[model samples]
Target: MLIDRTHRPWLIFSGAGLAVAAIGYVMYSAMVVGGPRGGSAVGLTYGIIGYAFMLFAGLIGLRKKYPIVRVGRATTWMRGHLWLGLLSFPLILFHAAFSLGAGSLTRALMVLFIVVIISGIFGAVLQHFLPRLLTERVQLETVYEQIDSVRGQLLEEAEKLVADLRSALEGDLSFAEEKQRAMAASAGTVGGLTFASGLGASEFTSQIVADFFDQQLRPFLLHSGGHHCALADKGQASGMFSQLRVQLPRNFWPKLADLESLCDEKRGLDRQRRMHHVLHGWLFVHIPISYALLLLAAVHAVFALRY
Candidate 1:
C-alpha cells in the first residue's frame, strides 16, 4: 500500500519501539557476564518479543485468506504487517545478538528470515509504485481475472467489423478466378489493395483488409500471439493502419478506425497483464518462505528451550 499520512502513527510507533529495544539491549549487554547470550534471561526476553512480532506479522496472511475472521480493519492489519514485519528483522537481529547462529537450525532460521524480509521489502516497493504506473498507462484496465474474456469480446467486435466491411463490398463474382489472379499480381502494391485488372476497387480493398486481418491482426488478438506480431509495437501498428487508411476509400475509414480502437484496447489489456504480474509475483516467493521461516523458528525455539 501507498505510504501516506495514514502510516504516520505506525511509523512513529515502530521507530520509538526500536529505540527502546536498542536501549534495553545495550543495558542488558553491559550488565551480563559473558555478554547477553540467547540463553540468558534478557536474551530470552528479546527472542520471545521478536517472535511475537513475527507471529503477528504472519497472521496478516491468515487475515487476508479468511476475511470472515474480522478481528481488525484490513488497513490496520496491513499497516501492522508492513511496519511490524520490518521491525521483526531488527528485533530478530537483537535476539541473535547480531550473530549469524551457533547451530544448523538457527542458521537456517536466520537465512529464511533474511529472505522473507528482503522479499517483503521488494513487494512493498512494487506495491507503492506499480498502481500509479498502471493507472497512467493502462486506460482500458479490466479485472485481472477477466482479461481473457475481455480480449475475446474485443476480437469478436473486430471480426464483426471486418465481416460488415466485406458484406458492403460484395458483388457478383463471375470472374472470381481472374480477380484472385489480379490480387496476386498486385501483391506488391500498398497492402496488396491496388486497382488491379478486372477487379473492382472496393472488392480488391476488401480482400486486402481481410487478408491483413487474417495474416497479422488475428494473431495479435489471440492470447499468446501478440508477442510476434507487428501490431504489438505501437509505432509499427500505427504505421500499418495509416497505410491502410491511405490505400482504402474514405467510406471505409470508419471501420478501419474502429478496428484500430479494438487493437488499442487489446494492447492496454496486455500492458495491464504485465503490470499485474510484476505487482503480485513476489508473493509466490515471499509467502511460502515466510511460512517456512515461522515453522523453522518454532522448531529452533523448542529445541533451544528443551535442551
Candidate 2:
C-alpha cells in the first residue's frame, strides 16, 4: 500500500498506510497470539518503534527556524512521524493488551508509553495550529530594515535641502544685510530666494515640511507646488518617499509614522522557532527521565520478585 503520497495525498497516505499496518498486525496476532514464544518479542518491538518515532518527531521540530536551513525539507519526515505514530499507537496498545496480570515493571512501561504518546500528541496539535494563526496576524508587517530603508532615503533628501538652506542664510546673506533684503529672502520661492536675508533658508527643518507630508506626498507637492515653499516650511520629500510608501500597504501608512512599531512582523518566525525548541527540548528532558523511570521500574520488579 505504498502509494504516491501526493494528489489527495494526506487522505490516501493515512488511509492506505493504516490499512496496510492493520492487515499486518492482524496477520501477526492471528499467527502467534496463542503461542507463548512471541509475546515478549512483540512487546519489545512495540517499545522500540514507539520510542524511535517519538524521537523522530522531536528531531524534526528541533530544526525549525534554523537560519541557514530555511526549508528543513520537513514535509516527508513529518509525514513519516505521523504515520509512524499511528502505527506505534496500535503496537503499544497490543503490547499492553496481551500482558494482563503482568509485573510492576510491565505496568510502569505501559504507563511510560501512554505518557509519551499523550505529550507527543499535545505537541503535534500546537505545532500545527499556532504557526498558521501567527502568520495571518502578522501578514501586514515586515522587517525593520525595509522601513529603515525609507527613513534613510528621507534623511538623505532632508540633508540636501539643509545644505541649500545653509548657502542662502550664511554664505551670501549675513547680519550686515538690510532688513528689506532679509524679508525678501525669507519670502520663499520655487528655485529659492536670491535676496540677501540674514535669516535665510538655512532655518529649514523637518517641522517645516511636516504638514505637507501626506500619503501621496509627491502629488500633494505637485498640486500645491505654487504655495509649496511659501505655505509649508521645507515642502514634501522626493519620489524617494513615494517609493518607500508603495512598498507597504495603506494601513502601513499610519504605522509608517514610526517604524519601530513593526515588531509584529517577526512574531510568526519567532513563535515557530520557540515551539520547535520546546518540542525538541523535551527529548533532552525525556531521555534522562526515561532512563530514570526504567531504572525505578526495574527496582520495583526486583523487589516484587524477592518478596
* Best candidate according to lDDT: 1
Q: Quote each prediction's TM-score.
A: 0.88, 0.39
* lDDT, candidate 2, 1-307, per-residue tens: 1223342465576577567656755666778756422235654555455555545545555555463575545666666655665556565555454453366666766677566666656556656665565456445433433543443444454344433433343434342235424455455332333432433323333223332343333222233122333312222332434444564324324323332121122232334344445545655654454455446544643664466
The CA lDDT at 88 in model 2 is 61
Indicate the residue-level lDDT of 296 in model 2: 58
lDDT of each: 0.82, 0.46
Q: Single out the weakest 10-residue window by summed lDDT for candidate 1.
A: 188-197
The Cα error of candidate 1 at residue 60, in Å, is 1.5
In candidate 1 the C-alpha lDDT for residue 280 amounts to: 91
lDDT of candidate model 2 versus the reference: 0.46
Q: How close is candidate 2 to the true structure, as a TM-score?
A: 0.39
Which numbered prediction scores highest in TM-score against the true structure? 1
RMSD of every prediction: 6.2, 13.2
lDDT of 2 at 211: 27
